[model samples]
Target: MRSRHVSVWIDAPPDVVYAFAADPHELSRWAAGLAEGSLRPSADGWVADSPMGQVTVQFSPPNTFGVLDHVVRLPSGEEVDNPMRVVAAAPGAAQSEVVFTVRQRPGISDEDFDADIAAVTADLQTLRGILEGQ
Candidate 1:
């Protein structure tokens, strides 16, 4: 799969950024096109009441390594893997970086890939703003 990676550095601790971004509900705030409405725990994982119907987001097991990966289940049962990571600038550092990996398949054109890159860049900017503004 072809993929693009975008990242933003925020003036906050990695733990804080990881805690907020790891939650599916919180993603709606920064990732505008991700989903909508409230998120609640469901049998499969965390479900969000979105305009596209109920979307499920299942995250990786909890860890202190800042690995905030997750999978999104569409209403049609298609799953999209969103690989994300929050890295501390250094040991005991207050600065951190959040990276998002956007993937595309064989049929994705250059224009679409560019658009996806821009969207991810915007989302990362929003994340930086939110974390830094706090």
Candidate 2:
């Protein structure tokens, strides 16, 4: 399995950032690629929809952390199930670190992996802006 981790330090409090991350509706608010999504009550957790596709929550801890059991179907019709986790850490009262870790399945080529990385990175940057009130 291939993995990618991206993190950003924000000027908001941990709870503030955590709250934003925890809310499914807020995801589309910050995530540029997510055109629409909603939180559904399910055995796994919440499920969301974006322009790229849909993802279901496999694990979540209240308002502080969560993981999305994501499956991305590329334009070529190749589907990859990447499990991603979002974590929030507060080292200071006024600062927080938001981290996203993605574990990709085998069979994805280097070029595809690079493209996925770029897309995720861009989404993280957008998340940072929303959380920081920028």
Candidate 3:
């Protein structure tokens, strides 16, 4: 198993940042490389399907803070679950921090985890731009 965590500071309150980040419509704003995605009601949480594959929202704290779990199905019928979490900085500050954590499944190699982290980091930069009014 492998994991990566990255965080960035945003010049906004926690709630404002959290709300924007949680919106499905806003996902495309940050996830630029994504092919497509749409909202789907699921017992898991808020789910969506994108070019990267199927992602399921796991725990969403009220006020838009939470974690989302994703799984991609390979052509060979194999599946890997990637755990992702978003943690916000305390409220009332001029800037807030958005943290992303990713952990790949057991059989997955470090190379795969590193690649995913790179992709996710790119999106995070996009996300920061959108929130910071760039």
Q: lDDT for every model?
A: 0.84, 0.61, 0.63
Instruction: Let me know the TM-score candidate 1 reaches against the reference structure.
Output: 0.86
The global Cα lDDT (0 to 1) of model 2 is 0.61
Stretches of candidate 1 exceeding 4 Å from the true structure: 49-53
The prediction achieving the highest TM-score against the true structure is 1
* Model 3 lDDT per residue over 9-100, tens place: 77776667777776665666686534255556677554556565665443344444345444544434455554544554654465777777
Candidate 2, residue 7: the lDDT equals: 71
Q: Report clashes for each candidate as comma-separated counts.
A: 0, 0, 0
How would you encode candidate 1's per-residue C-alpha lDDT over 1-134 as one tens digit per residue? 78888889999999999998877668888776566666788999988866568889899998899998889898988898989899999999999989889888567788977887888798889888898895
CA RMSD of all predictions: 2.0, 4.2, 3.8
Model 2, position 71, has a per-residue lDDT of: 47
Clashing pairs in 2: none
Q: What's the TM-score of each model vs. the native?
A: 0.86, 0.68, 0.69
Candidate with more favorable, higher TM-score: 1 or 2: 1
True-structure Cα RMSD, model 2: 4.2
Better of 1 and 3 by TM-score: 1
Best by lDDT: 1
